[model samples]
Target: MTAAHAPISAEPRRADFERWRRRSRLIRTLRVVLPAVIVLIFLGLIGSVAWSTFNAQPRAAQVGDEPIRLISPRFVGRDDKGRAFVLTAESAIRDRLDYQRVILKKPALVLDENGPDQMRINGADGVFHEQSGKLELSNGVRMEDAENAFTTAASLFDTKTGEVVGSGPIQGAGGLGEIQAQSYGVYGKGETMVFKGGVRTRLETKK
Candidate 1:
């Protein structure tokens, strides 16, 4: 006859089943939470990038009161009467406030009006008015041609009328002789020049 065996208890098996069920639930919850966490991180990164871009500063543009300068400038034009004239300067600067005027350095002016004589003028500095066709020269002004030479402190030339006038002490030497005058005027397209106000002259004798 076989000996009878004792039956095993079910309590240990039931406890193992419960532990496995809990572990399965924990794994399922973790799977759902991990995807949500990844989505949130991606959204946060995208928002941060967008915000930085919106707040970014723009690049600055390059941008002054400097006057316009010209090197070796020449102006040639005809007067209202269709007479031609030429003005040249070693250098010139446009006036900051006056658009129709220019400051000239080492200026030389030549006027030809289809006349018997041409007028030439030189000055250390001058102002040329474009609208009025006038030139005001100062600082050792000199006028010369085939017949006469004059030196004065200042002179004004009117291109429209073909006239030159100066006020101040003038010393001139020409075919007539040496002359000293308080003022002088040249008109008739530079054909006639007159000296007035304390005029004195010394004639040169021909050999």
Candidate 2:
């Protein structure tokens, strides 16, 4: 009896081994690349959401639906003798229902070419209703008395005696005096402007 031996081909074995190695490399490459792609997609989605949430907004000035507007306005306060003692800027917004009523009470004073003493504030925008007889001005408050000018964010002036009292920045110039006050109380019933708290006054004359 005789046995037959099979011949081995190294070329076939090498080809098969090369094919298997290529497939294995492809699978391993996918394992690393697929997770990296998924992580990038997740981060992109999160970034898009955060950007939309923060940037989506609008700035607003007025809160409600109202149709009232005012241009440059001026005001004047008079004394019992019919002489102008105080002058102020007049600007405000009000409901239509209360517009005429408000205007009639606190008329804006007309300014003379000369200055405060000869000025008249008779045009009205609103009235002061408090029993304490205080006048209030908001939104660009400016007051001019003779050579003096005082401006503030807002103010409370005494309707009875033309005095100012409140907490706000005030600047005034007149009668050889320059005043800057953080808070002030003006008693025009007297003859001088009084500055309170961090008051800086430059006097040009004593008399």
Candidate 3:
């Protein structure tokens, strides 16, 4: 014969059931609320980034009447025939009247660096017109190529037409000899030059 089994208490089992129910409810609530909190944080970060971008100012907008300064400003472009040209300035300032124009200090221009008509120009100061493709140089302008050298008080360059014209007196020296004129002009990408207005030339004779 087997001994009688003790009766199991229902109270303990009921308590265990209640505790399991509470734990399950807490896990479900966290599953829903945790994702919501994460989404809100992500949206806040995105909004902050957008606000900062909208309030930022551009480089050009910051310029004022005090003259924007640039160091070693350079411009590179091609002519009508696809010939490369370069313009560089030690320093540059934006024009007060027109924002599209720039004033360059100690500017240098190079045209067709590897071509037969390669030329280099230097000037104390220059004005560059962006829309018109015009460049004006002053304060003792000088130019040189493989065969000739020129000096002028002022000069103008037209990038569109590849022409360089003088505004004041000019002096030149080449294989032929010394030349002086009231005005001068260069065309054909520095292959041809013309001197005008009271021209004086002295050609050297071979001994």
Candidate maximizing TM-score = 3
- Model 2, 117-165: lDDT tens digits are 4322232333443344455555456666555677666666565565556
The TM-score values for the models, in the order shown, are 0.65, 0.41, 0.67
Please give the lDDT score at residue 46 for candidate 2: 100
Q: Candidate 1: lDDT over CA atoms? A: 0.86
Instruction: Put down candidate 1 lDDT per residue, 21-42, tens digits, no spaces.
Output: 9999999999999999999999
Error of 1 at 71 (Å): 0.9
Worst 10 residues of 1 by lDDT: 57-66
- Model 3 Cα lDDT, one tens digit per residue, 13-40: 9999999999999999999999999999
Worst 10 residues of 2 by lDDT: 101-110
Model 1: residues with Cα > 4 Å off, grouped in runs? 1-64, 80-82, 113-115, 205-207
lDDT winner among the candidates? 3
Candidate 3 has which clashing residue pairs, if any? none
> So what's the TM-score on candidate 2?
0.41
Q: What ranking emerges by lDDT with the best candidate at the front?
A: 3, 1, 2
